[model samples]
Target: SQQGEEDPQALSIQEGENATMNCSYKTSINNLQWYRQNSGRGLVHLILIRSNEREKHSGRLRVTLDTSKKSSSLLITASRAADTASYFCATDVRARVTETSGSRLTFGEGTQLTVNP
Candidate 1:
């Protein structure tokens, strides 16, 4: 996988606690996006931070990107039971493509977060 494993394959926390997950990739990227998937549901787009960005926040989500390290982190603040889901970090790397190739988002192994009420 172009994307390396995410830290903490699973996390269990009580409601209101923050959940943090980290993702690392092997190559330079154009941008990185975070997604969430509820049980038996499709992935939901969360936040997309660009390679030039250091950090960004949306709602209760905070994302950080370090292009020098080829790594990114997702922080879900003030978590709730409704926020329990699998979170994935996806990286778009145009550098891997050839003239006939297309850019794609490579997803890392997701982190399953369980927020107990």
Candidate 2:
């Protein structure tokens, strides 16, 4: 099965605010990565946390994982207008060569985040 599914497919916030989103998965994975994509732009890697870890942070981003529950959350603090983008969680699992691209990522549909300045 696919690894992650995020809730609240859309969100809106004012500048200098905080935004939080949750993701749930249904299988064991090697790692999970988050990515952001702005309108008409390519996706940018945000953060990645391995299954053995529980939490990780980068810049204004905070991510937490609960392996037991197969869930994860991303927190963006002191947001800015530039933060407006679509967020997606992708899972990485071990795959054999026949699996195609050899990338084990199964991406979610994504959460559209709009930050107003």
Candidate 3:
């Protein structure tokens, strides 16, 4: 319920073009993160954009967050076949009163990306 939901659950694209994915959540959040996971593997953290930040960049990846709309988007430019993976958006809900000290990341169903050569 509190987890973020991503759009375009499946995507197939050429190697050189860009790939875009969107995520939306229902509650206030401390931070939002993007992750990439290969088939049968653990997730690799890509970017962490805080609530105060509207946009962020890391290498060929760009992320934009809009707190007013409770939404975020990730863009991968000049994609390669190696970039193919399932991307997940994780959010830390600020409204939650938890005794746990560590981060409580809520992940969505993810958008599966396949970059063709």
Q: Count the backbone clashes (under 3 Å) in each candidate.
A: 0, 0, 0
Candidates ranked by TM-score, best first?
3, 1, 2
Candidate 1 clash pair list: none
Each prediction's TM-score against the native? 0.90, 0.89, 0.94
Off by over 4 Å in 3: 96-100
- lDDT of every predicted structure (CA atoms): 0.89, 0.88, 0.95
lDDT (10s digit) by residue, model 2, range 11-115: 999999999988888878778899999998898999999889999999999999999999899999999998999999988755532545666588988889999
Best candidate (score: lDDT): 3
What is the alpha-carbon RMSD of candidate 2 to the true structure? Answer: 2.6
The order by descending lDDT is 3, 1, 2
Residue 54's lDDT in candidate 2: 96
Q: Per-residue alpha-carbon lDDT of model 1 for 17-115, expressed as tens digits? A: 999999998877788899999999999999999888999999999999888988889998999999999999888766776678766888888999999
The reply for model 2, stretches above 4 Å from the true place, is: 95-102
Number of the top TM-score candidate:
3
Each candidate: RMSD: 2.2, 2.6, 1.6
Please, what are the lDDT tens digits per residue for candidate 3 over residues 20-93? 99999988899999999999999999999999999999999999999999999999999999999999999986
